[model samples]
Target: MWRIFSFPLSQIHPAVLALQLHLPNKHMVRFREDDIMSNIVDRERDKRTMLTAFFLKNKADETKPKYLYKDFPKHYTWNGATRTWTPRILKPQRGRIVSANPAEGERYYLRLLLSNVKGPTSFEDLCTVNGVTYATFRKAALEIGLIENDDSLSQCLTEASLFQFPNALRRLFATIMIFCEPGDIRKLWNEHFNAMSEDHQLYCQSVERVQNMVLTDIRAILQSMGKNLTDFDLPNLTEEDLQYGIHREVQEEYGIVVEAEDLCAKDELNSDQKLIFDEIMTHVDNDRPGVFFIDGPGGTGKTFLYKALLAQVRSRGLIALATASSGAAANNMPGGRTAHSRFKIPICVDNNSVCNIKKQSGTAELIRSSKLIIWDEASMAKRQAIEAVDRTLQDIIGVTLPFGGKIMVMGGDFRQVLPVIKRGTRAQIVDSSLRMSPLWSITKKMRLTINMRALNDPWYCGFLLRVGDGTEQSIEGSYIRIPDNMTIPCTDRQNSITELINAVFPSLQNNVHSSDYIISRAILTTKNDSVDEINDKMIDMFQGEEKVYYSFDEAEDDHHNYYPTEFLNSLTVSGLPPHKLRLKIGCPIILLRNIDPSHGLCNGTRLICRGFQRNVIDAEIVVGQHTGKRVFLPRIPLCLSEDDMFPFKLKRKQFPIRLSFAMTINKAQGQTIPNVGVFLPDSVFSHGQLYVALSRGISRKNTKVLVHPAKDFKQPGVYTSNVVYREVLLDG
Candidate 1:
């Protein structure tokens, strides 16, 4: 008879101990041992006997039992002296509990099981649960000799245990069962102990420290819910640990510190401005969409507040853009662009043409990347035009829902001029108008208060605001006394108006640094005239002032300097003299196209001409950039076709000679002129038109408006006809 002996025991036959342990379970006797050798032999044999007994027990328990003991092999010998069992080691099977006690490496095996059950798990998750680094785990596996240093089995195991913990651990248990037999666990323990580095050994000493603080915290929480540590799966533990760890890591990594107040204060703002700013900031903070309408009479610092908000946005690293309905309005504030230009919206000519082609092109890509857009002079933009921009933005940014990408700020007085379009019915007009849209509807309901206007001025601000609302006694005002120091006379309407033009033109030309002294006029000389008559008049005007104007034919063929010479010659043929002209490199010019009213020529319809060069017989007009399309205009006087007509019906040359006069209100958008001359002709004085024209010239110090009689000037809405009037008093 053989007996197995464990440490410090050598007195018993292991086979006798095993037989004794099994004899009782077979009958009525129970096996017990005081000696270590007997205990070792007894336990091993007991396992074998139990295995056989379990088969027999199942046969007895089942109603229809299969034959089992007939196929069972004979039991092996047990030696007490060596504590050995003589049966082949069986493969460890997955999901089978090898040990129930926590003391004999049960916790370590449990962790391995959990790791295998979870699939493709993160090291962070494992570290979070085990309170150990990947390096430490790898070193331990190597020292234990469970895996070779070159095998990478530990790393593979760690990688496979990412998110699914219980699953990964089960798989890991199955894997260990394949490689590790029941007899090999002792060898594994010795290898694991040998693999520990000095630091890891020291860390192992503090394992209880980590387990007590971190693991204990988690265990306690789970235990309160009646869960055993063994039953607490790794995934739940990982999630709990990871959330806490991530917060701690982020705080450490970013060094984030909360402040008591915002860095920039709003102490300088007025009540209304402060309210608007606060509202905008609140929306930004909450990531909500907000639309604000700052409606104020002229001179109310609406632009100033807009700029301040832009600065605030920039300081916060947010992208922002500003636009206006007209170039003049865009120029009202610094760094502003026309809405059409900013959004790359096409100027509508043919009703069927694409209204916003740029949005479909690369320009949309650019606009989508911007975080904020501010549109001024919104009143002048047609509903269709605004809609086109909105649609384009929505398409480019993939904003299926409303207000998707960035903040949009639109500023304009609705009383100003409406957009100009050619052929649309009343219903179409109503559908496409900006003021009638859902956005505007909501805005009107919100009733965003005005920030600045004439109310700020001591003399005219209050009066204009009241009159603009149509609540004042009358829209007219008495003629105020003109200062004696004013060079231009303000007595008679036309004289004062002409003097204002003469004074302002030189200043404008100088401010723009234009070297060419070119002044083209399109005067309405007759109510009814044939195309021939208009042509004859144009030719007469061209030939009338040869000394002042040199024809293109008269220009010398000096290619090196011909551009300036040819430009002068063209102007000279048009009644301007070369000697009087001062053409500068960067001067701004306006080019108007002669429209056939009978064909669809209209007041609001014109080409925006930029960039200029002089050729041999023509002046090359840069309609866009060098990369854009360009055209050449002959120096010779050209005739208008009989088909040419104005939208408003004027005689030939009614809006004649494609005059490039001082910049018009539309062209002057988004520009700041040191000196401006505003002509409020009686014909151009409707409530809407007045606002459009007045607002074009923004600076009070250098802006002047010439009107018929001061009493003839009428207030139609909240903004003054005198838009350039200063809010602050100027001491001369």
Candidate 2:
């Protein structure tokens, strides 16, 4: 047998290792190649040739099967015969346009040629010599009218379809696609473009050219929808365009437009309401802007007065921008928007922060022309948010007065959720409230005495007042015992929850899938865990086949993946959809994101699950002005950076919906329901929460509260906490 040598070993023989001949020392010895050849055959080169030939034969054999070298999941299978990878059957992508333009056709042809020939991208790459093919592309572009004399690159882009170019122009291509596609860009511009004046557009164009400016007047308008100057070409949008966009947005997002018959609603106002309405209207009539606050608990017909005021101003053909601090409240008022959305208030605000409104902008025009601005649920907003608006308004109107001397009607029960200072103490929370703002001193106080919710039941009204005022007889400092009539009598906590559910959602077995019946009431809770528990129980109770949807959760920051998939799956947090979302057909669900406001698919919008498909589901709006309207919902990427519960920022791409059978008290704050069931497994940790939860019911008869008793007290009676900050309630 011959030994095969590899690399450096080929130069050496075993005879060298056996040599003991000494050249420099007594023990050294050496042998010649002939000595080794006498005992061995030189077959190393032959063996090497055989191995090389074997590998070459395998490489050149085209008939042999090939398999995917990369490992894939079970769902993806590799076929050796076809040398292809295939996935399990899936529905084709929807709303995707394939044939966009001549450029796309050319690109497709190029791709086909490359596939067939397995050639390089360019002819130069295939050729042994360097040459140019720029003329070829230019000629093709000219033939298709994509290039013409005196045409700028921007102009050419506007004239051509997005798909005409390859993927190198990612941002520009995406923007163009948005303009042509059935999405936000077209919807926003088309609805508001004509409303902009030519001069305003010119002004916006000039401002947009200022590269060094911190924020331009034109960008202010476009930035509301995450749009920027780069999204459009020359002759950019004017201030008028931006204003119109805001107007259309307010129209679509709030669904609060006042109709001809809406003016007649003023005649139905109560005496207290009529007085406040007249007092506010007096300021509008005098052309003098005034700040007024309507102090009233929930169910006091506050929203009724909001409509009356909107009707009065709009009936005269004057603009009355109605807004609320919360989405649920915004929906209640016609043409209402959240204060932040309408004012373009910064998400993070400080004392020096002004709203993103510009003096030369369309929003400024709307504000200047508006006779009144109604901000409902004002108390829930941070004091800085209110001041930010005031500063921006004063700057826009060029006035040294409050809110730029604009007639502002702010309404909310201060007794409800105050400014939420995340993890702040009582002092911090009270100080952050709108009542603590400097504008509060100038605000004319208007109180709504009569509780329209408990109009027929004085007892319920009194109970709510005591709860709000902190006069409720507490077992300790803040803990109080629930009155008998307000609670469902049950010994066990589980039984109490069952009774509470039965009270709010009666005939569930029969009307489980009824959108109207299901949304008629909801179980309100203080904690997410309790809300989830109740939702699970209600979903299980619903009569239908359940379809489970899991979210793709990951960290937003580029850090270590310390948080595992299982950990994220088990999290229960506010303003986040669950990891496991189980829904049944016809079950009521609330939208977690604002998909389309014009179609009434805004946040806080209630919809019923209709059908499910790949990456999407069909839902019909069961609440708000667009009720009965069916819309398709797709899994969208969602991020929650504002929430501080998670260590690192969390991101989840999933359907933006959650079961509506039960929701948190914070979510139910600005909403009013005919029948409300308050399930307090744990006492409320924030101020105004208990009051907000209890006040959601239309009347005491329709509302029922069940609180977990104090530890070691396993009785039917309920114990609750009243978190009121007296400092915030004090008159400035």
Instruction: Predict model 2's lDDT versus the native.
Output: 0.65
Poorest stretch of ten by lDDT in candidate 1: 723-732
For all predicted structures, in order, the TM-scores are 0.39, 0.67
lDDT of 1 by residue, 523-542 (tens): 11111121123223323332
Candidate 1's TM-score reads 0.39
Please report, in order, the local distance difference test score of every candidate based on alpha carbons. Answer: 0.38, 0.65
Over 4 Å off in model 1, which ranges? 1-268, 331-335, 349-362, 403-405, 422-433, 444-457, 470-681, 692-732
